[model samples]
Target: MANGVERELVLLFSEEELREMSGVKRGGEYIEVTCGCTSHRYGDAVGRLRVFINGELEITCECTPGCDEDTMTPAAFEKHSGRETARKWKNNVWVIVNGEKVPLSKTVLLKYYNQASKNGNGSHRSNNGRVCHRDEFVRCNKCNKERRFRLRTKEECRIHHDALAVANWKCADMPFDK
Candidate 1:
């Protein structure tokens, strides 16, 4: 089973701020691109980002209406790092969420998503390659505070349910999921 990871993208401007700066009127609705390819909308809490994870510099138009013409042009955002293997356009950017800046890099993202195991803990991830979200209770070793969250169970197989297995839980940030 593959473990899941979460990576964040930090934007320079908030989605709302970007809408204002880009001359997009807000009506709590999706805005149509100049070419009318497709309408774009941001969620109430989170905004989506279209980013390239490969080294290729392929740019496409978000314009709907079936226009084949490319819309946005790629600009040199940063220099290539020594560890980065991308030969062309730097596919790295930042996103802002809740007034916090999060760096989005292809290399960094790839490093995170490519791993099948946790950095230290081997059992925190579910068989579905995601952080366990099943309800569980665990006492922290440091603060000794019992934190309950939704994570997966050890005997979670394809068959019967185990109501008695409720107490079998993982720790909160323990060296291992004991």
Candidate 2:
């Protein structure tokens, strides 16, 4: 946005999809779920995925040191990419269709927000306050804006974060180059 507000996209999924990720398990806890071993553009595997008792998902990107780490609502965890064949487990928008996976609009996503759930994702940015970096968001004090830098190297994000933390940067300065 011109104002520098990050675009927060919270995906939604079907109930069946949640069951698939969680495998019809216990309740009220973060159950460690297996995530794809796909090699991220930056580095290693995609890290871990967890489902809360209330049907929320927590994902961490094992791609890099400062990779992805965030929680998703049941709705997002259940969305089927509609492109999967044998349900190749994913933590993002794509879910399994033959089982549980479907798209829901903003109104539709919010509608299900009120449903009772254990360890639920909670609002899941149904309002705002979600980041947008590495698939998660990062902030910049100098620009007074928070957005993705798309830094090529893992060190870039770390440096950018450090610069921001130490207030050693100016909005006019580039974190490095491009």
Candidate 3:
């Protein structure tokens, strides 16, 4: 009877279960486990099979059984998830930052807007009242120094433009050049 009970227990866990049990569990609040070709489990699951950290589900799996457990806070989950899947384009546009897709928030859009407004009209217009034909001739509005302001359309000196824009927007008014 004892021998039969042991044999039954061995048969209960299928081959797949045996493989999963053998695989490594990389422990972390947010861990990514890959079972290589030997295992056919890869899919994100939240709760239950997935474990959480700080009161929120942080560890997402690409495995089949789905995730179980809750351990991270909502804030931590968002932060971790965002970083895991951030992708960038050749054009320097971050298609995804962290796991969240780009353009989902105002961060990228605001960056684009500020880049477009960098040179102000002054740099575009030459002394003759003609638009500067050379990209390098445009003077940064903030620094009053000439640079290849091709990347940004605003008049800010490359170093100060982003900071100025952020300050201006935060204050609900254009920042005074100090």
Candidate 4:
């Protein structure tokens, strides 16, 4: 039973992964746990796992770029990815699915996940950039006229909104130059 538990720990967290997550110095004496009662070397083959698995050491997520050293229990660590998986993205970290970036409007769903994760949240912007949906009348500064713009959904709104944003005009009737 002890060996099986040890195997699970090794499978879940490699020594390197634990080191990165713990934010301990490379060649220091055995690092101390949060409780300050137990300590183990980051590279220890068996003792490292014992420190973590036995709950003698608390696993804090120090790997993410802006993480605040949030404590991640062994179970939480197992449920999430480690530092190595973070750099796999060529560009910014995105909520990709099946090798495709999810759309901007769908970002609300990702926000929900971020709240649940209680740790490093995914990028707030989409690859497409900011997409604003306006469903009201606005006075155009250039033409000095009121224009109505209504965008009900994300899919139907991005292109139109992006184009109007670049042109810096409200609607066709309220053209910028005119």
Candidate 5:
């Protein structure tokens, strides 16, 4: 919409070109770093972003569960944004596949989550000033008991998962052999 018109072709913008485009920012690679189409208030006819805690990013469409997500490089993403494609990644808006608007479901994912809650499949998390992971599943050979090392759901599961992939890690749950 640089000229107040929606182009039929996706525009691959250089950093300079993007800086001049609407709903673009100056601090990202491939796609817009600061914002995406899903949450853009300016009505960007492109995909939105979801930056993970580990700095990974994903381009998500404005649809509910199981809806197709558009994946492409920055250039291809802009190309598909054309009105002719029909699969539109409108900013802060809904997705339009083949000229059909894809509505965001208010209960699809929520329904599954509610079911998970009722089953008690993910409702136990206790910290004892140390790690509190499920020991029953991974009982140690020496103690034949569950060891706490940071795998609880409520605790920092993600951080622990990342940190555990190291070459040197001493298990506090492991008893010192006397």
Candidate 6:
């Protein structure tokens, strides 16, 4: 009964017929059907069909003739449309996640790229003296090795060395101080 919604005149199918056709059991506790048309003003017409089940608002599928089956729950739909999540970066870029600029692996970056692209901004590095460029790897201040710096001060670094020397530091626990 909402605006833009129309009641269809299609014949109702029996529970057995619906089950056989779509493998979904009908004759549940609740069922409601609603339809509406989207005014695009350009391109093809878009229609919506909603089905409620068990007294709960359920499936809402969009129909445009050539469109694919893009049916989902409200939570999933919002996440896919980049409306309820943060942007994700891709390709081992330096990104600030939870206030730390860390090198994200390629796998992590790909998962959030599309969402980030829609949010009007790309991945950003934190301002805690961490490198921001994707190609620039972090180098240790003492050894110049391509290792992730843990933001330790000179005093902390010295303490780490002393602890290791006392234990005859094993390679398994090289730089991390206890």
- Residue 40, candidate 3: C-alpha displacement in angstroms: 24
In order, candidate lDDTs are 0.31, 0.39, 0.32, 0.36, 0.36, 0.33
Off by over 4 Å in 6: 1-29, 40-54, 60-62, 73-178
State the displacement of the C-alpha of residue 166, model 2, in Å, after optimal TM-score superposition: 62
lDDT at 72, model 4: 47
List candidate 5 segments past 4 Å from native: 1-93, 103-138, 150-178
The whole-model C-alpha lDDT of candidate 5 against the native structure comes to: 0.36
- Top-TM-score candidate index: 2
Give one digit per residue, the lDDT tens place, for model 1 in 1-178. 1111112122212354344222222221222111111112321111222323221222233323454444342222222112132223233333343344433442232232323332235345656756553354455455757764434544442111332244443343333344
What TM-score quantifies how close candidate 1 is to the native fold? 0.21
lDDT score, candidate 6: 0.33
lDDT of 2: 0.39
The runs of at least 3 residues in candidate 3 whose Cα sits more than 4 Å from the true structure, single-residue gaps closed, are: 1-92, 95-98, 103-108, 125-178
Please give the distance, in angstroms, between residue 38's alpha carbon in candidate 6 and its true position after superposition: 2.2
lDDT of 5 by residue, 1-178 (tens): 4332222112333344334333333232323332233322334444554322222334544334554656553233434344334333232223333344333222111111122342255444444434335532234445455445444554446545543454343444333439
Q: In candidate 6, how many Å is residue 59 off?
A: 4.0
lDDT of 1: 0.31
Model 6, 1-178: lDDT tens digits are 3221222211233343223221132223322232222222322222222233212223344444565646654333323333323233122122233334333332122222232333233333455834343222233444545543332455644545454354333333445547
Lowest lDDT 10-residue stretch of candidate 1: 1-10
TM-score, cand. 5? 0.21
Instruction: Choose the strongest candidate by lDDT.
Output: 2
Alpha carbon deviation, residue 24, candidate 3 (Å): 33
